[model samples]
Target: MGTGNADADAVLRILVVEDEALIALELECLLDDLGHVTVGVAGNATEAIAMGRSTAPDVALVDIHLVDGPTGIEVARALSADRRTTVVFMTANAKRIPADFAGAIGVIAKPYSERVVASTLDYVADRRAGRDGPACPDGFWPAPV
Candidate 1:
């Protein structure tokens, strides 16, 4: 657990569940620049589950649809079951998200700005560390906890 400080110890282990290779790569670069590290990148539900289990990432940035179809919802449900993992969806089809968010804590709409992604991750880190993070950004939708 972190101390709610934005230091090296606050770096979050991230898992990216997205089907688009280019987008995945871009996100990886951004995460790295933000001083966080990506544990793995999964293009499909099966791969996402396997990697998530093995890596036990602090956060998972998941897409609504993957290479195997709209299985990101299933992936989120499974990963978020592990109390150590926090799931956030990054998708264009926010409408497809069920009322419960399938166990995800929040969502970021696609075509997202890097600033939004960065702020969301910071907020997640703070909350994970038991601190009330900054206010949810404009582009983010936080599920009622």
Candidate 2:
């Protein structure tokens, strides 16, 4: 099984699918701090779908609500077609998620803390490392006050 460091290899290319510009930028910055590369940022499902096909990122962070017709769940399903890519949903709505997205790494609730985001990323990385069980890396903290 691959280790967390193995998952962090290859620049950890990622795609951010969000309609809100500020949130997108925030996520991009966070990914940057983690040493991950943001290959593409899309405002809606259609654009996200296109980017997914072209960029082929190692992971995709998608917001549930987008400008385009389909929700982020739709985009997640589309991007996840490539087994190499991990799909993570970002939204304030944590009550429920589509049944089709059962395979997603996890949901990152909005108004997200840096700790939440970091933990989510670490979890995804661990899963990619072939660890079936949940694993939360140390040193995560909520967004600064």
Candidate 3:
């Protein structure tokens, strides 16, 4: 885990940006199980940006594609202007991630299992806590061991 003194149970406010309802709910459940708080869910980039501005979540889990014209990276860039918001991309098309988003804290490929999600959450939490340098969680791109 990344270095930090913050409690693992810390309630991190989070925003979920995904076009699919089922996936959004699943992500919410995963966040809940991790003791994180889901502040908002957006099906498109527009709403995601709006929610990010309004809620100012600690982190945002964004999918590459949204219902609207702008992509998740676009929303991340806009919302991240505050610099306090951490961004993670959850997408099947890892290769499609914007070049600039390579600087994001982490990326989780789709078809992720419970373990993968958990590890990603740990990585994010650690990053927020200032424990480890921002990097995609180990094994995030590979199938769960």
Instruction: Name the candidate that leads on lDDT.
Output: 1
Say which prediction, candidate 2 or candidate 3, comes out ahead on lDDT.
Answer: 3
Put down candidate 2 lDDT per residue, 101-125, tens digits, no spaces: 6456667777777766666676666
Q: Tell me the spans in candidate 3 whose CA falls farther than 4 Å from its real position.
A: 1-9, 132-136, 141-145
Residue 66 lDDT, candidate 1, scale 0-100: 96
lDDT of 1 by residue, 22-101 (tens): 99999999888888989999999999999999999999999989998999999999999999999999999898998899
TM-score of candidate 1 on Cα atoms, chains taken together:
0.93
- Model 1: worst 10 consecutive residues (lDDT sum): 1-10
Among the numbered candidates, top TM-score falls to: 1
TM-score of every model versus the real structure: 0.93, 0.80, 0.82
Candidate 1's C-alpha runs over 4 A off are 1-6
Write one digit per residue (lDDT tens) for candidate 3, span 1-145: 2232247545588899999999999888877777778999999987988998899888888888789744877887877776778787888777777656744555787877767777777676766677757566565652222
RMSD to true structure for each model, in Å? 3.3, 6.3, 4.9
Which residue pairs in model 3 clash with each other? 3-131
